[model samples]
Target: MSVSKLAQERLGDYILKYCLLFEINIFYFTFHTTELRSKHSTKYFLLCCFQTCFHALCRKFPPSVNYRKRFLTELIRRQETVDHAPLDELYDALADVVGAEEKSECYKSYLLPCGDTVSLLENVALISEGTTGLVTWEAALYLAEWALDHQQVFTGRTILELGSGVGFTGITICRSCSPKKFIFSDCHTTVLEKLRDNVQLNGLTEKMSPAVSVEELDWMTVTKEQIKEMEVNTVIAADVVYHPDIVESLVKLLSKILSGSAEGAPKILICSTIRNSETYSGFKQQLEAAGISHHVITGPVRKVFPYNRDSFIEMITLYK
Candidate 1:
């Protein structure tokens, strides 16, 4: 049976989202007979899904073994509902995962709209090594979507990212937006180490155009000289406004970077998840007190990465 255009689109989306390890509930696999006529069509769809996910598991930078096991288990559980036995390949993949030792690190790959993939080696835990920078945050995904939509802002421009955890947004911009230079900055030792590995994993080393570099930048201790030396035309950050204390230092850092620029102040774009209302409000107030003007900018037109859609994330633009 031929699948409708809508069904084909939905199947493609499901397959890509699964490969990226997006949160797939059991309900997603509950296929209706009316929608897909004939057992053959249903089986074809299931095979396509499993093959894409299996390829992701065997990729050079694969997801964690635990994650792969969970995915395979879900697919196997759905096989009974379809009145069909699980594919032998699916069982084999699960066996491999079960036999392998689990690691603290894993890889998450995002397929960009430009047909390029941004893969990063990230910590499996939400917070690791006394810092949350070891993994990509929701706000980083939000900001990356926005940047891809506004490619002109970064194209041919030198960009500096503050608190660039795991280098997701920066790498995405460098690959898709065609930035002249991309610098990823963070203070945590473990975060920086993993960030550099991710950059190389994505093949964004210095040898490539839009020269990519990782720097250790502590917002509290960063100086005007340091910001000036970077000579960036644009400054961006994501998920760096979690605490009230950091608000003061971030505002000061933005002020220094803007003032020290020779070819006029570099544009500042900051994206943050509104986990705490008071903390977010304090960020804006600090920007005002420091003579920096900020306005809430529009979000991305579409999402290219998987993230918590329910979370409230805001993107703001700062200027002198």
Candidate 2:
């Protein structure tokens, strides 16, 4: 049984589970391969495939991988179960699995540590925190990759990421972007803690990596004190504009973060892929009406051969 074969067998189910919330292509990337015992051919093949998926979505002169999304449009046919549970436990358990499974480090040793609930990587109902977190329908990794490709926006700047799922994008910047600092903010303290553990699992900390912080930031009710407490100068969010109802409140939070800054000015960079025309149109209008116009930059996302249906990010820059 080759590792690739083993991985492929599970990839379909994983894709289906992820597709329940996002486009299935979002979960089809290569899992971690940093310290695989597999041969170079297998390892390199996995890496190339991942790059292809990323590049295809980022619009980087298309690669050679031709993948599609509708293959799973009818695949993830499960209704999202909204069982009530503490979010911290969910984030901790899920983050442990994701961080350990991450190619960055700690795989094989961390297999969804807390065996209490549904996989945080898949289950949505278990995520508990201060204010409710609306489902943001997009891959957080692609957003991180897009932001990394544009290091100039984050280079030497204090950056903050809200609703950082598995802390992939913020962690990506800690590893790839030349930011002075990176803060991974989430509503659930459990997610924040797992994000912290992930940073460590990857051997990243103040001692070994760039400056990073994780905090509880319920966007809807964030106070002036909370905004002032953060030292961030730029904010980045991925696929966070899905729900039209929360756009105004979320933008207001970003506005508050930007409003209190003394240094030149703060920018809120939101990345999304057009999931639905109605949501995209309304979110854009909401941002503009609040005096925060949006800037769209097509990122060079993938290196693989991309199909028209590859997962990608929509880079949005906001300013008053």
Candidate 3:
């Protein structure tokens, strides 16, 4: 595909994934044609791209404020490089995405390198509905990047994700990693609802991709029987160590799940953002107390997603 086709594909994927009604109709215009000797077609195509992007910013489920703001700002900055004069729509779009009020519900879409995309409808507020689990964390992005880099870790393995927030990591893995099964587990009802929405949004439901399921898991009260029944051989958690109590609960639950695995003790991978030193240390202390051995992992040379490369994201490989 040509460069413009690739761009349209990516943008179309994002629009469909997020259900960006305001931005969905822009790609109908011809953007990848090379034989356009007439300036009319070229101008029309460019207008479609920029105008739809502006309309997207004015929509309810537009991209994140920071992303839209930066995109608009950069467009205004680089408009002079193009063959056409800048349109007033560019400044209006900048103001729309920048000055729009935050909505309670919005979408976040991630375009994968393999032309697949993972999108989510999430709460704009961090602590929405009395739970922080509604928002995707940095560690989840980091873990998804790591998983995409190391596909062998999940290939043909039944994977279970603990504390899957909005199903970003799970959906990404389902698309990129060749896993036998993927079970996404979380506790919050609101988060679970949105998680299932995201999973279905990515078309990973049983109807489309038979190997995915969303389950409600209470880490503190889960029984060994449930873990055994899952028949999972790999476990993963991302950004689950925010609270000390939660860390204790997670370690205890992980110890039980790992010890009771019928598939020869599943491989456990925990990815966390080291936001607070003491909280992370408490997590380590809990892991040690549970008699589970874990070590930091550091072998991925490249990342698969666009995220903060300099963030303090770390992965620990745990074993029984």
Candidate 1, 1-320: lDDT as tens digits: 56666766666656665443543443454544455445655555455555455554436667777767776787666655564655776677678778889899887777888777777888889987899998889999999999989999999999999999999999989988999899999999888898888888888888789898999998888888888888899999999999886788888898899799878899999999999999999888888889999889999989677667899999999988
- Answer with 1 or 2, whichever has the higher lDDT: 1
How displaced is residue 79 in candidate 2, in Å? 37
Residue 92 lDDT (model 2): 34
Deviation from truth (RMSD, Å), model 3:
6.3
Candidate 2, residues 116-229: lDDT per residue as tens digits? 111122223323453233222345555655664677878888888888756656666666666888877787755666666665655566654477777777888888667766
Better of 1 and 2 by TM-score: 1
Candidate No. with top lDDT: 1
Q: Write the per-residue lDDT of candidate 3 for residues 176-265, one digit (tens) a residue.
A: 988989999999998899998888878887655438999999998999988999999899999898887677788889889878876588
Residue 260: error of model 3 in Å?
Answer: 0.9
Off by over 4 Å in 2: 1-138, 301-312
Pick the TM-score winner.
1
Clashing pairs in 1: none
* Winner of 1 and 3 under TM-score: 1
The segments of candidate 3 whose C-alpha lies over 4 angstroms from its true place after superposition are: 1-61, 64-70, 80-85, 89-101
